[model samples]
Target: MYIATYIIDIAALIYLMGLLYSNAALNTSRKKPFLIAIILTIVIILSEAGTVLTNNGSLNLRGINIVCNVLGFILTPMIPIAITLIFSRMILTTHKLLLISTFINIVATALSPIFGFIFYVDANNQYIRGDYFFVFIIVYIINLLILVIITLEVGKTNNYPIIGKLVGLSIFTIIGTSIQIVYPFTYSSWHCVTLSLLLYFF
Candidate 1:
């Protein structure tokens, strides 16, 4: 688990390094989307840190626990959103389905802390899964399905200029997300996301 965790942290760190080294070219059309992804990746690092500490069961700080849970819950949905945004220009639109679904997720996450609709921390500060825990899974599945459908229907193809990179990003990200959803115990999504975005940028 720690191995996976450190590897993801390193992946995210390498992305940060890209900003320093690749800024010359990234300063063009890629600047906005690249910065958005970089910011989201940094947040994923924090979210993964929270998950790590929670699983460790050593630093049982209630406030930190709650804060981490809320942030992690809120941030997870945004990765797909940011990724979609990065690819929007290429796809020719803002992607109504992705935008709407992600917006719903954002709204639900905002209410989670208050209503515990998704998850809540107890007095002990231990992470507690909520009744609507499956909501997260459902949302992610929808996002991936929409992405795949788009990829097949209208996404850039093998003959297209950026086909290989987009195909690689979509496949790897879906696999990583599926693993995290099925296991719900492994901390691998962030690394996969980092890799996907890195593929996009470079």
Candidate 2:
């Protein structure tokens, strides 16, 4: 599981780098979205690394894991906004929404330590599930809805196939994210891997 997760993380990082390069090369309106995606990708990679290190019983790098988790919690919602912007090509609506969502997500994550009992450290010094896990799940669902709505609106106005692809990808991502959130003990790496592939292809 760890190796699989690491492989996926590396692939995601590579895809993000490619996106950054493509955005730099093309004078497209999706630049900001692509950049945001890159940032999220970096955060995800760091979080995954943190998980792996901690899981392996390494205490020296546990602080890095905490940092990654905090960052991941903050940046998770911005992903859908970035996706909507990248494929939809509408700057005003998508960009503004992304900014707002990012701010909200940051605030939520910052407050999680205080109010979110969804996560806690176990006696073994490992990160354990918290009681307020549902809150994060709710936030993810809202983010997914926003992505879908934005995609639909863009598709209606432009009638682009990319919009359709984005919608499909967003649905897959939402489902994958939901599965993991709802069933914390189950295996959902495939969903994540598939979503990452969809993002790369789309």
Candidate 3:
């Protein structure tokens, strides 16, 4: 399971890099969010790798899991913000809804340390899933709603290509969010990898 997860993570990292390059080539102002997404992806990949290495006894990297915890709590939520930015450029209109969504993303990320409890390792280094896991589900739903709104807004205004990209992104967000929700049970990393591919292709 770890090997599969790691392979998917590596693919996701490559996809994020590609997205960065593509956005740069198009001179899109959305590059900042994409760059941020890239950072988030890197952090996730490293965190997973660090966990696996430490577990396998290949490297005694202390505090690595803590880093993973921090990144997952803080950085993962920025994905919606990144999508908002990307769609903003393609749609060419700054709606109040987008602003609100961005604010929500920021707030959620900031409050992650306090509110995040989906899956955390306790002081004894034992994995303890939080009781407030449903909170993350609600958050994911909101994020998905935002993506849907963005897709609709983009489609209502933009040309076919941009609308198509938005549609694709929306699908990716849905799939990725679903994967994340089931991650604990299934332990699959394909969610992030597929999300990165969507980001790259879109």
Candidate 4:
């Protein structure tokens, strides 16, 4: 049943491999944030894979399952926050606000193992959403919206000719994640994210 998820994970891995071997010099301040975004994507991918494997009974390591779920919930929002940092010229206040929101999510997710506020793993090693799952959804959406807005703002400030490309990438990300949100069994969000990162790098 998770064959599609596994395939998407492999595709993301290939995408990362191509990026690493492309000889792209990530020396600029802007490019540095892009690198960070890529790294966060890698972490999220691993966390997601671990969660899927454990949830499917392929792995019985409950401790690892809990850790993976925690990592996935906490780190998913940080990707967009890192994307926001790609725009060094963005307002400092906006940066602070985004950071604050991410911090709140980190705290909430970190404490959720005991509190079960965001998610928890059951005795059968099944992943379960908590009452505050909406918190994660809202934060993810807000950060994505901010990412789109910041990209537009920066593209206009610099008069970038590829603003349409940026918008296209943002729309792709939105659609990809929305599908996964509506159908939790699907595993396309990170793959879409990986594709977006590849497009952004070019």
- For each candidate, the alpha-carbon lDDT, in order, equals 0.67, 0.62, 0.57, 0.78
Instruction: Quote each prediction's TM-score.
Output: 0.78, 0.75, 0.68, 0.86
Higher-scoring candidate on TM-score, 2 or 4: 4
lDDT of 3 at 138: 65
Ordered list by lDDT, greatest first: 4, 1, 2, 3
Compared with the true structure, what per-residue lDDT tens digits does model 2 show for residues 141-187? Answer: 67678778877886778777676666677777778776866675453
The whole-model C-alpha lDDT of candidate 1 against the native structure comes to 0.67
Better by TM-score, candidate 4 or 3: 4
Better of 3 and 4 by lDDT: 4
Error of 2 at 11 (Å): 3.4
- Over 81-128, each residue of candidate 1 has an lDDT whose tens digit, in order, gives 556655455433655545566667667766776787787766655566
CA deviation > 4 Å runs, candidate 3: 1-8, 11-25, 51-62, 89-119, 161-165, 183-185, 189-202
lDDT of 3 at 172: 66
TM-score winner between 1 and 4, please give it: 4
| lDDT winner between candidates 2 and 4 | 4
Candidate 4 off by > 4 Å: 1-26, 56-60, 89-94
User: Which candidate leads the pack in lDDT?
Assistant: 4
Positional deviation of residue 75's Cα in model 4 after best superposition, in angstroms: 0.8
RMSD of each: 3.4, 3.7, 4.6, 2.7
Candidate 2 error regions (>4 Å) = 19-26, 55-62, 88-105, 114-116, 185-202
Clashes per candidate, residues 3 or more apart or on different chains: 0, 1, 0, 0
